[model samples]
Target: MKSICGDLLLQRLGPEGLGAFGKPLNRGLYECIRGAILDGSLPRATRLPPQRDLAAELGLSRNTVMYAYEQLLAEGYLRARTGSGTFVADTAPESYLNATAAAITDAGPRAMPGLSPRGQQLLANASASPTQWGAFMPGVPDLRRFPHRRYAQISARLWRQPPPEWLSYGHGGGLPALREAVAAHLRVARSVRCDAEQVLITEGIHQAIDLVVRLLGSTGDQAWVEEPSYWGIRGVLQVSDIGMVPMPVDDEGLTLPEADAGRLSGRTEPAPRFIFVTPSHQYPLGAVMSLKRRRALLEFARQHGSWIVEDDYDSEFRFSGQPIPSLQGMEADAPVIYIGTFSKTLYPGLRMGYLVLPRELAGAFQTAHAELYRAGHLMTQATVAEFMQAGDYAAHIRRMRPLYARRRAVLAALIERYLGPGALNAQGSNAGLHLVLRLPDDADDVAITAAARAKGIMVRPLSRYYLGTPAQRGLLLGYACVPEEDIGPAFDVLLGCLGECGHAAHVARIG
Candidate 1:
């Protein structure tokens, strides 16, 4: 060999490589030389042939070889010594190639590096369903009925005449216009005591919960979460590494624990720092927190210096009279943080909700929220503001209430018809999108849930919602997404999935 194989580049470049298809030879030559160096066809430090000699060998002009070499040199793909020829630079691309190959070989039998321990733990306890929308899918709205025309019209209009901050990442406490609108709506509809300044907009209820818990919660702080509560909220707490004490839920909502945590556990937990409750309508089980209990919760929080996170979920669709007023508005300067989501009222994908914080702490939380999530979506927020201010939001809620009411009635009847009257758990049936269908204690709710999912219905196992060993067994069946006409057919499908042990007894009595 003449010091180094100058023909290696030519061998890798191939017969049709540089001049193929009438492509520009200079650029092609550059790429071919670079590729050879990158792929190890031309080993590092291997000197290339003289430009004139290489051009003559390849039947190209001297300028072409010079151009490719000059480009490669300028781009660090080649190095030149004072009197020596062009050579491939000592790049570590080969190490990467070797590592990739080694990884493939090692991956076959090895446990690869996985997520963080906390991340792995959070995922291991996850309960979110793969399929979100189907028969009896809880918390999903009727997607067909979303007011797309108005939202699009407003969105297009905003984009057409865009303002300076139309899409800006400003708004520490969310867009002022949207905050004002939310404040007005909550004051009127929910009786939430807040000015626009107190409203902290968020992506949704989960974000609101997470924000509160992370900011208000501290090391060794414990939160009183309702037993048989929303799993999503619990997941957030677990990820934050905050301890939770599952308080029971009865018809009155999250029941106050009779004994101190230390007394029960034989170890003193720091006096609880937060209390989470769905006071408007209890989740999975529809019980409104009584005014007495609400007052007591307020007093307890006052005593313990705890912040009560009141999730006013699905309070708008009450079949009877007006929805319950917020726990935040219960007493002046009450230690309650009222949170609500547009997911239930509008649509889940809308991904907007708000927190009505205490006026004393609102600004600090707003700054923290801005720093944390880097809140934006001014356009969407503004559109919703316009919609609510113009009474369109209330109008949508007005229309949805009766529609959901009819579907709920239809589903309830079918449950009573097919699964028997006793199977329809009356506790959570009166309001909200979903109701519980009780099963016997020994019944396999998880198996029933799986079977129903296989058959294209989606009811949740009640036992999964519990923070402790489940007190009872049942299934949560949502009627909001299911149309009136679809309820009977869906329940009939679900009924077929139920085993004879718990279901047939009820069915037999009916028969």
Candidate 2:
């Protein structure tokens, strides 16, 4: 056993072995042994060499070996037997050991656990980017300029002396203070008609949409989504087993047919149980739903007994004209679930968002939210509440609005300069973090997007946002996170890719 121990240790610990040359020898030995144990090179319950023998073999002082063994023993990595030598402890938990065994045994091709139909659909329809932050990555804010210092201070202060209840599982509706703050801000800023009681906090629009889908409708129920809509919401609907009817969008937003035609004639699909829209600023395309359209939608929903989900994400960043009031607040008792997120206005990592539910539905959604997800994060909510109360939230938006506007202008100018007129058309630049660059009818947006990505420019294919065959071919170029200086260069790279795709000719044309 002793002879075999030396060979095993020497083989495992390679040439410049146990001790890091410049560091303390004992600490280095300790780290090497710890790593070996963690990596399963030293199996659980394997006997370790006696301290004196190990010291002799390694030419180390007995005390040093003893120290390392003692530390390992104290940490439960090794167990000292009364009459026997030290062995690796069985402290590797059952779960860990089982997982390790499974990994080893299942190394070859094996039947993997099958996903549900819905799970398979989710995997097939997955649109989340592998890398979220970089040049021209759409839908991300400029995190570099975020007020981290102030937020950190507030976070630290709250954590130091948090309320007793706050440390526990929070209210399903969210932190009271946060709900009030959000309600007050929404009423004033976005004209959302809601009080604190109606504000149900969620992880973000993702979860908010999930709750609405689960609570209001059942599996196989029909819902209406824009022709080219936000893919995230489409995913939620699909996973919920809800059938989605893709409604086309014009310059005025979702173009719904007359209710009588939609319902009576078999030409159009039957009225959906719910309608999902981004009316404040249409996603990817940047068209505001006209007041007439908004009223028409509300009337349609009212007549059809359908609920509306207005995802007013990034509405606060509007660059031109007065900000639009929410569709939810436009009429009295409008059956609209107004969803907003701090992810865009603040930061995505915060994972805070809220829904202004209809008065009667709030209680049920709150109960289900608690039952299903078990709400917490009161500390984060409280910190955000303070930030809003102190007027920092509003000030941050004020500071970023112009900065984003400049970045938008730079990207737009580059497109006009490089791509030339009639080469590519850019739309939806009046508001939001991104805009749509419409390609020619013959262009393959998916191939163009892949080409752009290969050049280190991250742009989404406009066709990917559609439920069925895309009506238009284009790219969704996000300029929010890209610095003003980098926007031109990134778009130039993209233009080069476009030229390669034969979409843009190298003719000199005036902007």
Estimated TM-score for each candidate: 0.78, 0.80
Listed per model in order, the count of residue pairs whose N, CA or C atoms clash below 3 Å is 1, 0
Tens-digit lDDT string for candidate 1 (151-193)? 7888788778878776678657898999999999889988888
The TM-score of candidate 1 is 0.78
User: How accurate locally, in lDDT, is each candidate?
Assistant: 0.83, 0.84
Model 2: per-residue lDDT, tens digit, 1-511?
A: 3555556666655676665335677876765666667668788888888888988877778887888889888877889889898998876543445665223233688798899988988999899888788888888999999999998999999999888989888766999888999999999999999999999999999999999999989988999899889999999989899999998988889988755643734444667899999999888688899999999999889888899999999999999999899999999899899999999899998888899999998899899999989899989899999999999999999999999999988877776676655434433638899866777767898999889888899999989999999888888888999998787778778879988998766332312
- In model 1, the worst 10-residue window by lDDT is 99-108
- Report residue 265 deviation for candidate 1 (angstroms): 12
